[model samples]
Target: MERALKRYWPIFILPTLLAFLIGFIVPFVQGLYLSFCQFTTVNNAKWVGLSNYIKVFKDTTFTDAMKFTIAFTVVSVILINVLGFAIALALTRKLAGTNIFRTVFFMPNLIGGIVLGYIWQILINCVLSIVGEPLLALNTQAGYWGMIILTCWQQIGYMMIIYIAGLQNIPDDLIEAAQIDGASSWTTLWRIKLPMVMPSITICMFLSLTNGFKLFDQNLALTAGEPYHSTEMLAYNIYNTFYARAGAQWKGIGQAKAVIFCIIVVAISMIQLKATRSKEVQQ
Candidate 1:
């Protein structure tokens, strides 16, 4: 069986490899090249060297977007993980209708991002109208908090499912032993459950971090970076730079921003994984 599997490995892998190269690798390499050149299209690219990178740094809007995105990611990551884990702990207990509750909580995540954004926009606007702020786009703070709330609502359920799985995988004897040893519920959670769930934490954190960074559709539909682009995120900023601006130079600058964005996300994700994985206990 092993020999037969080995013989057919290339046959199984070749199509996926070819698809990946064609869909991702080739375009990525081309994008990197285009970042160094000014062009409206691939055929007419003119080499412009480091000027695009320089322009990216000099753009105040891009810097603002970076700051906004980082702030949002940090807040959203904390809220989603903590709330999700707490909900997971609750649901894993011998609660009534646990499956129904899980299904309802997770339903928000299944909704499209654009649809969620519009739904929240109208809901928030209505609430704010009672206090005289009729539109979310007009208030920068409202837009910021609205995005955070919307993200947390959508993501917590998914993270909760991961945490629930982790909790279930933990040996029942360990928890029972802790209780027999006179450990309080808090002590058992902190010293037993949380440590055992570090692997789930790592996975949930990585997903939340990346999703927060890459948020675009919600940002577009919710506030559209209104009130002078105060709520613009890095992804939306790059999109606007590429499509909203006229002239070919903006495309090169946009590509450079994208490359920088990719590097930042990759570096942060690697660091987060290393940090979290170190604390994970082997089952």
Candidate 2:
């Protein structure tokens, strides 16, 4: 059976491999090439060399978006993971209605990002209006915090579920041994549960980090980079550069921005994965 499975593995994998190459790899390679060319369409690309990349750096909007995105991602990742882990810890206890609570928490994640954004926008605006405060789009600080709240509300539940799974998978015997050894709850958690749950921590951190960086639809629906693009994130900034503007040069510049965006996300995600995975326990 093992020999037959091994021999047929390539056959099973071939279709998916071909689809990946056609769907992702081919387009990615073409995009990397087009980033160096000026073209309104793929068929009419004219080599422009490093001009697009140079323009990308010169664009202050792009720089502001990069800064805003980095700040948002950092805050959102920390809040989502910490809150999710805390909620997971609470729910894992022999609490009443645990399943119901989990379902309630996770339901927000099932909502579309655009829908969540609009819903939060309305809700926040209503509250602000009641208090005579400026609307989300009119206030830079409000817009920033609005995105953070929207991201955390949508993501914390998903991270909580992962944390719950990790907590549940801890060996009962190991926990019992810690208690039997006169270990305090905090010590047991820090020494045993944390190390044991490092795998989930790694997965949750990776997802949160990437999601924060790649965020677009929510940004579009929520603030739309209002108050002079001060709240714009990198993804939304690229979208504006790509589709919201005109001309072949803009297209080339957008492509270049996309390539740079891809590199930033890939680099940060790799660093986060490496950092988290290093702390993960073997079990």
Candidate 3:
């Protein structure tokens, strides 16, 4: 079996390799090249050096989007992880209808982001209407909180599933041993349960962080960066630059913004993984 598999490895791999090159590698390289060129379309792109990047930084809207995006991502990441972990802890006990409870909680995550955005907008506006305002009223600060609340409500359950799996993977013998040693629940939680769940924490953090940064549909559907682009995030900012405006040499500038956004997200994810990994302990 080993010899046969080894001999046929390339046959199994070739199709996937070809698809990857055609689908991703080529397009990715093409995108990088286009970032330095000015064009309305792929075929008409003209080299424009660093001007697109300069414009990106020069736009105050872009800067505001960056700040807003970073702030939202930070807050959302914390809330999602904490709430997810807390729910995981509760659901781990011997409760009736645990599966049903999990399904109910996780249903929100299965909903489309755009749908969730509108659903939340209607609900929030219904309450805010009493104050003579609506979801997109006032400024980005209001939109920022609305976005955070929407994110937490939608994502916490998904992360909760991850934490639940981590909790279940922990051995009962370890908890019994800790209890026998006169360790209290707080000590056991801080020392044993948390360490055992570090893997789940790492995964949840990465997902929430990346998703927070890349959130577009919800932001678009909910606010569309209304009130003078005050609520615009990085993704929406890029989209507005790419399609909403005309005769602005959209393609290259959008591509450049995308490339920079990718680099920033990758670097931040790497740093977060490194920082969190250092504190993780083996069970």
Candidate 4:
């Protein structure tokens, strides 16, 4: 049986592998090549070396988008993880209607990003209208905070579920031992629960970080990089460069920006994994 299973494993995996190659690797290679070429279409691509990359660096909108994206990612990652963990802790306690609360909190995550964006847009605009301030589309600061709030609201519940799973896995005996040793609640959390939950923390942080960086549909539907493109994020910037702008050169530049964006996300995710995994305590 073992021999048959091992022999058939590749057969079982071949279809998915072929699909991955066709769906991802092929297009990725094509995109990498196109990043160095100027063309309106793949068939007409003409290699221009690193000129597209150079143009990407020189684009002020790209730089601004990069800065804004980094700031937003940092804020959203922190808020989502912290708030999610906090809620998980609360919900795990001896509280009434905990399941109901969990369901309510998690429902937002089920909504599509574009739908969430439009819904939040109307909600935010209504609030600003009541306050007699400029709408989200016209106010850069408002747009930034609105995105932050929207991201946190959508992600916190998902993270909470992960945290709850992690927290529940912590042995009751270990917690009792901590309390028996006169450890305060805060001490138990800081020293025991946190370390035990490090794996979940790593997962949640990676998701939040990457989602923050790759955000697009929400950014588009929410602010549309309005008020002179001050709120444009890196993903939106790449999209604008590729589709919104005219000319073949812009396409190549957008491709280069996308390649750079991919590299940035991979590098940052690697760094985050390394940092978080180091602190993870093996159970």
lDDT: the better of candidates 1 and 2: 1
- Candidate 3 lDDT over 1-283, as tens digits, reads 9999999999999999999999999999999998999987788889999988888888788898999999999999999999899999989997998899899889999999999989887777777777766556554566888899999999999999999999999999999999999999999999899998898889999999999999999999888898788889999999998888787477677888999999999999999999888878766
TM-score of every candidate relative to the true structure: 0.99, 0.97, 0.96, 0.98
Clash count in backbone of candidate 2: 0
Q: What digit string (tens of lDDT, one per residue) describes model 4 on residues 1-283?
A: 9999898999989999999999999999999999999999999999999999999999999999999999999999999999999999999996999999999999999999999999999999999999999998789999999999999999999999999999999999999999999999999999999999999999999999999999999999999998789999999999999999999999999999999999999999999999999999988
Provide the clash count, candidate 3.
Answer: 0
Error of 2 at 163 (Å): 0.4
Could you list the CA RMSD of all candidates, in the order they appear? 0.8, 1.0, 1.4, 0.8
Q: What C-alpha lDDT does candidate 3 achieve relative to the native structure?
A: 0.90
Extract clashing residue pairs from model 1: none
- lDDT against true structure, model 2: 0.95
Candidate 3 — which residues are off by over 4 angstroms?
none
> lDDT of candidate 4 vs native?
0.97
Residue 184 lDDT in candidate 1: 100
Please give the CA lDDT of all the candidate structures.
0.96, 0.95, 0.90, 0.97
Candidate 2 vs. true structure, TM-score: 0.97
Number of the predicted model whose lDDT against the real structure is largest: 4
